[model samples]
Target: MRGDSWTESYLRSDIMRESVIYQAILEEGELSAKLTSIPRLLVLGLTREQIAQALDLEIEQVPQVIEGQN
Candidate 1:
């Protein structure tokens, strides 16, 4: 009975893995140290100023680290 229910659910397309784009967005907070800020910015909706404010860093430095990501 349990196996039949699972097979029916799979065939019905109600349970599926997340899309790659959504997975990428979910992984925004997990970039490596070298790619941290920039990749995070690309993956999410936060602006440089907002990120800088949240990080307690200089606003000018945000551009340097997050360049070409826009």
Candidate 2:
């Protein structure tokens, strides 16, 4: 197959989604999004414990995320 066709086939949404690299990227993006939301949740009156539980993050990780945002 030509390079363009091969690349296109490999990058198709369904095929890309099945790749281990793609899955890892997706998970990282999800975790980033969750971490990014922590400060907002705090401003809305959620404690570190509540945010950790609601976001399914470790309690220790909550403070770390907050610190990183500073």
Candidate 3:
């Protein structure tokens, strides 16, 4: 019964295995390092000051990193 339910859920969505969002969700901690990337960190609504604090970086260094990305 448990195996049947697992198979049912897996087959319910025809595109689950090919879905980027689903794959990303399954990756779990695989993206932990990317979470600290400046652009990704900014997209998650972190301010420069907050990012600097979290990364142990100088507050002034944040803008330079942002500028270089542009």
Candidate 4:
């Protein structure tokens, strides 16, 4: 997905990852990450809650944004 920037790059970007992490952990997970405030999609100072809010979801319903490298 990361290789082909046109096909799946949009779905596997850092911003997208953050959104997924924020939403998945928020609703499905046990809130173990403790994401409080919102996040910056620019990767400057993004938080768990920020990603969730950006994705139009609750802090407790955000997904887990795993680093593509790791």
Candidate 5:
């Protein structure tokens, strides 16, 4: 049946990894982690430019994330 096959496929790690939704979730988590680390990096004396380069984020995005923290 279609429902059984869908369930089986969903349970497979390879199939789940190939899913668009799964990829989006992974991207979101990665971004969240990067954003969370910004403050710590700043405290450690890294400049916004350095953090942006280190995290592979936009230079503009670093200030925005910094602003959001306050």
Candidate 6:
């Protein structure tokens, strides 16, 4: 009975950890998409500050993001 309880606890902990990692992965993907779209938004008449605000990024980070895309 004790071993079964330990196994269950371990499984739950592992599942929780995996869930956190999965969330991080999804956030990274969303950020990547945002970064890629910055240039397109700029070409479409959005100013750098506006793009940064819309994407929830720092205005200073905009150039770096564009550089990375290039």
Report every candidate's CA lDDT: 0.65, 0.90, 0.74, 0.55, 0.92, 0.92
Total residue pair clashes for candidate 1: 0
Question: What is the Cα-based lDDT of residue 2 in candidate 2?
Answer: 100
TM-score of each model, paired residue for residue: 0.40, 0.72, 0.47, 0.27, 0.74, 0.86
| lDDT by residue for model 5 (1-70), tens | 9999988877886676669787898899999999999999999999999999999999999999889978
The ten-residue window of minimal lDDT in model 2 covers 13-22
lDDT of 4 by residue, 1-70 (tens): 5567665666668678899889987775544333332223525666656677665656564443333223
Q: List model 6 lDDT by residue over 1-70, tens digit each.
A: 9999999999999999999999999999999898888999989999889999999988988898777777
Candidate 6 residue-wise lDDT at 32: 88
Worst 10 residues of 1 by lDDT: 29-38
Error of 4 at 51 (Å): 1.0
Report RMSD for candidate 1.
9.2
Q: Give me the displacement of residue 13 in model 4, in angstroms.
A: 37
lDDT of candidate 2 over 1-70, digit per residue (tens): 6999978876896575678787898899999999999999999999999999999999999999888878
The lDDT, on a scale of 0 to 1, for candidate 6 is 0.92
What is the alpha-carbon lDDT for the whole of candidate 5? 0.92
The model with the greater lDDT, 1 or 4, is 1
- Candidate 1 stretches greater than 4 Å from native: 1-35, 68-70
Candidate ranking (TM-score, best to worst): 6, 5, 2, 3, 1, 4
Worst 10 residues of 4 by lDDT: 31-40
- Cα displacement (Å) at residue 8, model 2: 18
By summed lDDT, which 10 consecutive residues of candidate 5 come out lowest? Answer: 9-18
> How big is the RMSD of model 3?
8.8
Worst 10 residues of 3 by lDDT: 27-36
